[model samples]
Target: MKDDEPEDTGSTLPRRQLGRLLREAREATGMSLEEAARLMEWGKSTLSRLERGKSERVRIRDVIGLCELFGTDEEKTAAIRELAEQAPVRSWWRSYGDVIAARFNTYLGLEAGASELAIFQPLIVPGILQTTDYARTLDRQYFSRDTDEELDRRVGIRMQRQHIITRQRQPVQLSVVLHESVLRTTVGSRQIMAGQLRHIADLSTRDNIQVRILPFRAGFPAGIVVSQFIIMSFPKDSRGKPVEPTVVFAESFTGDVYLEETGDVRRCRETFRTLQRATLDDRPSRDLMREIAREHDSER
Candidate 1:
């Protein structure tokens, strides 16, 4: 990283998507990055950066040269070049700055672009569905060192992401599956939990949103514990092919990981399907959520 090089505040999704496509195409031709670089008469690091989507600028001619070299079909080359052109565009979340971690910016971009999403939560509510108060409660604990203003901005971003699900045009088709434990788990207080449960129940009624709950009686699908994961699929292009591949997001205490390979994504999809079979139906899940919310309300 050069000292004079501009900082990457965010907005690398298109570049990252381009890089992944190019990398996959290159591998399909059975050529190593080093060999491709040598063949293109470009430095190895230059090709490496392009492949990793870490380059500051993506040149149209550069993409064309590589596509021609790899013998990529004209249709695919055009799509890949379009992605290159979009690489430098700014993302809305970039305005929030360090309030949003650099590691998390990519997921935000993917989430915004997703046409359909499958979210699984074994513990807490997913961020897009979290109410303002519920979000503040979680942030207050995790970002305890930050000033109130900083925390407010943090929560603000959470609320902004919800727009992708709520927009009147092209809203994401969202499916959320929660373990029954999430409804029972007390967050902040009984009152907060009541609001959160009711919130999910309300949102479940939307045409684009489906909420299902996995009960304890099901005893874990396949008797194996599954961590939280989100599977995001993109819209198709004029050719009826995905603009970008399906991506599976798995978050942890530290950094996150994205699974993009066909087999891995299929496995996650199957896992989600298996879990869905064990979950209560739409009406039943809403009933359970409301039932729990009432129990919280009745509590002294």
Candidate 2:
């Protein structure tokens, strides 16, 4: 099999993992895709798309039918159905066409579907939580030549993406550790920075989100600096293994980086833990946020 081929070991995309499970169950019952589709009253193409991960969407009722047809255990049936429900929702980001780089979108899709996300940002706020004004200010300062329309659209996409934290039945659990300088840095006007700090404070109170600050006093124990990365973990599958190996996303000036190998994940996780240890707890972080807000108010 090709290196990128979906593994039957259950370490793959949700759809691919589900497909492999379905294939296993069907074969155990000596049923083909056509036979199974017919038994479930689904179109042949529908089953084909599902098996290929081209269409990962499925209803609980359909899962029930498959379970009954294949005589699958209730546990397996439940896990498969959950994967279908947890498939990443299609978003307007898709409309960006080729403008948004593929690596970025791939990470976004993983973020949208992740049950939990952990990030360590040394220089800036995590993108999903960045305020529109802050995002625009950063874009303007960095890309002065870019048209206003382009900037606005980028900011709009970012705001929409933030919904991943708020709109879901169980909002994605987010734990972010940002460097202390991020709070002190004036990305926008003084007023905007103050507003941004207050916003961060508000978001930290959210039940599913936690924000911490890593002070410079911690020094560079990990031998890394000025890098931001996120780790996404998917819900488990029928076999009780994580659906996909954790994916690490790192951004650069010109393009992005995606790390899926085991060694990279281990190093990123270690770095995250190291940063976590150096950071203030959530309560203290909130206090720092309020302090910044007060400073902004005083300057005003």
Top candidate by lDDT: 1
Off by over 4 Å in 2: 1-104, 143-147
Residues 117-231 of candidate 2 have per-residue lDDT tens digits of: 8888888887888899999998887768879998998789889888988875888888898888888888877888888988988999999999998887878757767488887
* Cand. 1 TM to true fold: 0.70
Candidate 2 C-alpha error for residue 10, in Å: 5.7
Each model's TM-score, in the order given? 0.70, 0.67
**Per-residue lDDT for 130 in model 2?**
89
Residues 75-124, candidate 1, lDDT per residue (tens digit)? Answer: 67866776677635323112223322332355777898888899999999
In order, candidate lDDTs are: 0.81, 0.73
